[model samples]
Target: MSLLDVHRSIVVIIDLQGKLMDMIYRPNLVISSTIRLMKLADLFEVPVVITEQYPKGLGSTHPQVLSVYEKLTTKKFYMEKDSFGCCEDQFYSILKNARPDTNKQQIIIAGIEAHVCVMQTVIELQENGYEAHVCWECVSGRGEEYRDHALQRMNQKGAIITNHESVGFEWARDKNHPKFKEMSRLFREGQITS
Candidate 1:
């Protein structure tokens, strides 16, 4: 929809743990895009939620991501989940509490291991009436084939697949907007490079 519509969207970063992130290809790309998404969300005042899948075993979220969260004045809900699909009771409860007032019932998602955690979460989010949009460049798996298949399946289930920059511009809408300069600067400086 329009940038105003996407402005009401919530950003959910799932299971981007330190150990798990190390196993994925192009981890830097994922981390950079995710952090940029977080920063943009902050600028727009959109809510953000992060989840760690079995963090006790996989380890906490990467230091870079954790550092960003620490600086946010917006309350970020961080959950430790054993379930692959983060749309379970706990996360659903968080969603219920943080539900946007606008009609944009959307979830902008990014994370690690696309084939499992990200895939299952997006599927469940769609099933639960949320428009789940997955940022492709911000997600990855241990293998390219698995990541490809997961994206294909998510597309089949109606998850909008896109890249980080597109999502930013879609949300920003016009160059004349107040945040346009900052977003453009971020893009030009390669802060959100994929």
Candidate 2:
């Protein structure tokens, strides 16, 4: 796959909701990485689509992500769904309504339960002909094994497994890009060093 072009990409934040989020392994890392991804999306004018899986039961999205999203003035797409895979009719309609431009075919994914929702979404994204790139640090499952296996499965199924920093740099493309400095700052600060 080619480096992500900011103008040709979209970030999809999936099912990072309440209690389920709390149970995910290293939830803090996931949250911080996802926040950085959101900021990068905002900086590059990349559209973001956030989904909640039955929020009435799982509760709402984690406040940190919600806060960053709320502050963005760019066109945003938010949907609440019961489907584990976000490729449902409703999501398709929202994506369509967003008027997904021809170049905006690359989808960057981040969220919880990598073995399920994230994996399913990535598979479906590929089926729909969109290149899927999963931000490794931004997705987690309740168990390390689950997360690893999910990523392996995704890679086997044609999804590119990558990190947030790689995605940001790929989007920026060069130091000469207007937002490179801020993107670099975000890359440094957003990393979780054990």
Candidate 3:
């Protein structure tokens, strides 16, 4: 499938909560990438789903990231899931409801504790017939080692590993396209500049 085919894809932001965010290494980077991803989703009119893993115990999603969602004009499905992999009943229901009736079977995912929630969800998505692609730099754990290991394991399990910019460009596909100029400007001048 094409990168810009994200219009048919869903963007899942998994478990990027308050308590977890505090413990993650490079939380700022993940948060920033998430915001960028969300912005791109809005620009492209892609569906977005966000999960908070037991928000009461873990606190809410980080304030900064949460604020971005509030500003989005696009439809967003928000859920509090106790399951690590968001492929559980509630989340899957949301996914089914939000899914565009098209050939885009891809799911672009990013979130915290890569080895746990992110890894599990990506695997489940693949098993369930969705093309799962994880944005590497947009996911992290409490330590660099843990993050590295999770990424390695996810790659081994057949997830398409990529970075945030790569995802954005893939969605844009062509420099001369209308959305291309806007997407490029947002990437080059927005908070996600790498």
Candidate 4:
């Protein structure tokens, strides 16, 4: 129920690896939404944490996504892990090091395999007292049904189920905000429909 405060938030794009991304349902939609979300985060100066679940096996985070991050602030925190839930020790360490202020705990989660990695990450993030906002449009599973069930399950478990556009506008708060023009441009390029 509340809008995401950029000062209290961080963007977490998880496990959007190579082959897996191509297999996910609606891969183009998910990737486009995620790219826009990351762009919004960059515009707002929110810390971005990207993870790959065994990249050696799954391949690196999709090249297109990587290219976007590369253009943004060089402050990208990249983590590689075997764990499904990104709430691991290394993740905590990187996050802590990224922001250092304990109060910045709102997590905007976007990525693939909604029913598995995304689901587990949201659950553990909520359990750890972090406000986990799941970007519905930016998440997908191997099947549409699984992604739908995952979103329902995460919502039931207290993660705020939202889309990338909602998150972007909520964080921007007002059109007069300094980054508004840039944010608007990104959304337009994304061709996100109401």
lDDT of 4 by residue, 24-119 (tens): 888888878888888888888888989999998899988888899888873579899898888899998887877786664888999878999999
Q: In candidate 1, which residue pairs clash? A: none
Error of 2 at 15 (Å): 0.6
Candidate 2 lDDT over 118-158, as tens digits, reads 99999998988889999999999998999999999999999
What would the per-residue lDDT of candidate 3 be over residues 126-166, giving only the tens digit for each residue?
Answer: 77777888888789998999989988887787788887678
User: Global CA lDDT of candidate 2, please?
Assistant: 0.87
TM-score of 4: 0.94
Name the lDDT value of residue 172 in candidate 2. 79
Clashing pairs in 2: none
Clash statistics: count for each candidate = 0, 0, 1, 0
Question: Residue 74 of model 1: what lDDT?
Answer: 62
Which is the better candidate, 2 or 3, if ranked by TM-score? 2
Error of 1 at 44 (Å): 1.0
Poorest 10 consecutive residues of model 1 by lDDT?
1-10
Off by over 4 Å in 1: 1-4, 191-194
lDDT of 2 at 21: 86
Cα lDDT, all candidates: 0.82, 0.87, 0.83, 0.86
